[model samples]
Target: MSRHFETAPGLCEARDTATNAYVFNQTMLRIKDPERTLDFYTRVLGMTLVKKLPFPKMEFTLYFLAAIPDSQLEQWSKDDGERLAQTFGRPAMLELTYNWGDKDKAEVNYHNGNSEPKGFGHIGFAVPDLAAACARFDSLGVTYVKRPEDGKMNNIAFIQDPDGYWIEIFSPENLEQGLSEHLGSDQDQR
Candidate 1:
């Protein structure tokens, strides 16, 4: 036997007024080699390296990447401080934290959160064309955890990053089709 859980109710109306201004920002990941990780993200994934901040005293650096449109990139501020402020203001960015001297070490200093004691699952990206994106990834020799046609959820695919973090990929059309079919099946069950 199995159990179905109901969706959690929304927050109180009073709280909505205070929380409406909140915006979800970036997710940070610890990287071993900044060069390799940056190459993978910027080259393979087509993300723009918006800002890079080095802290010599702290012995760490922060690299911010975002999937901003090329048109928007063209209009970005020429001033360094303003550009950084713009990067900070944007949502849905990826922050890679690179500790000094970690790249020189033979062993990875941080866990990818998918092995042994698992915690953070994965981050996802929505592409315009799933098939073409997967094909491009194949050409680039990107490691796949699950191909689009591999399992029950054939509409989605998962690929690994340089640090072994899983990145889920799917297109809007496929996601909508899958969701509609799933919802229809659930309606039949009810």
Candidate 2:
């Protein structure tokens, strides 16, 4: 299907489209050990150690990881356990703890075991800008596994966090000098 940036063609796209009227916020990963999982995210992926909280009367802890401050998310995390117990209906985020109380516990990860399924797998996410995001990864010394590639509908790229978690970034348009072979330009595909 043909896609255009603008809804009416000549005019600009709607305001909500910039941040996305919809976006996947958080993903709760099931880790054999939460501590090890923490290591991979903060140290490897470079997402700031955001927040952590104990699940009342349980051996588990809930962590909130994010690349930026999301105010709406803070409300969900800080709610009481009884409320959170009701909200775990989603697949990814486990719970939301109060930002003020949990920040102190967040820290960097030190890889100690085979991350495997214990940590997250290849998570594809959108960015504000595609090429700029890849450049940030480059500056952080994060190895770019697959340079950005343009699709018929989306721009994409791949990279690995320090823990060996593969991440793919997707955007609405083309990456300036992204990998082009993914298109039918590939002789094999053609």
Candidate 3:
């Protein structure tokens, strides 16, 4: 019931264009509480707070976070200008935007994109150990959308952030093995 589409020839040939230097820097999410959201990302998820830019005039603040390794931590902490340069160069960084007065509001102002309207799907993070990671999330009182054993695809799990954003978790090995098994089953059925 699924159809596969090949890349158009013209688009495939456009790889030689000058856009090669472009890198996917980050994705932004609007959050209500900086304290709770920042704690969830930094303390629970173990991402480093790379930079914090406050726009008082705009009444919002930007927080950049990345899963930086220990070795690179010292370097990123050294200088402001260099830290920002390095942060911008990295891919898959998360930007959390907090409007100054949102914390005082009774209700969350933004949609997590997973409910009724359903536009943005979810963000993913590949873990080294799926079981252990899920356990850690459990101990930290994180909310779960799906547990690995709950669905047909048992290799993946989904956890929710403080702002109700879904984060898909999986191990690379398990994901590949799951795909292989599914494909083999499809072939066997044919």
Best by TM-score: 3
lDDT of each: 0.87, 0.53, 0.87
Candidate 3 residue pairs that clash: none
User: Which 10-residue span in candidate 1 carries the lowest summed lDDT?
Assistant: 1-10
If both were scored by TM-score, which would come out higher, candidate 1 or candidate 2?
A: 1
Q: Which regions in candidate 2 have their CA more than 4 angstroms from the true location?
A: 1-69, 94-121, 149-154, 173-190
Can you write out model 2's per-residue Cα lDDT over 1-190, one digit (the tens) per residue? 3345334326543455566534454654444445555665566444544446665666456676655335544544455665444343333332222223233454633332236435334666667787787787778677666776533434677776543446777664554434364444334553
**Candidate 1 structure quality by residue, lDDT tens digits, 96-189:** 9999999999875677678889899789999999999999999999999999999778789999998899999999877977666556443566
Error of 1 at 140 (Å): 0.4
Clashing pairs in 1: none
In model 3, state the lDDT of residue 65.
96
lDDT of 3 by residue, 30-122 (tens): 999999999999888889999999999898999999998888787674788888898899899999999899899997567878888989878
TM-score of each: 0.87, 0.45, 0.87
Q: Name every residue pair that clashes in candidate 2.
A: 28-92, 28-93, 39-109, 44-162, 77-96, 77-97, 78-97, 78-98
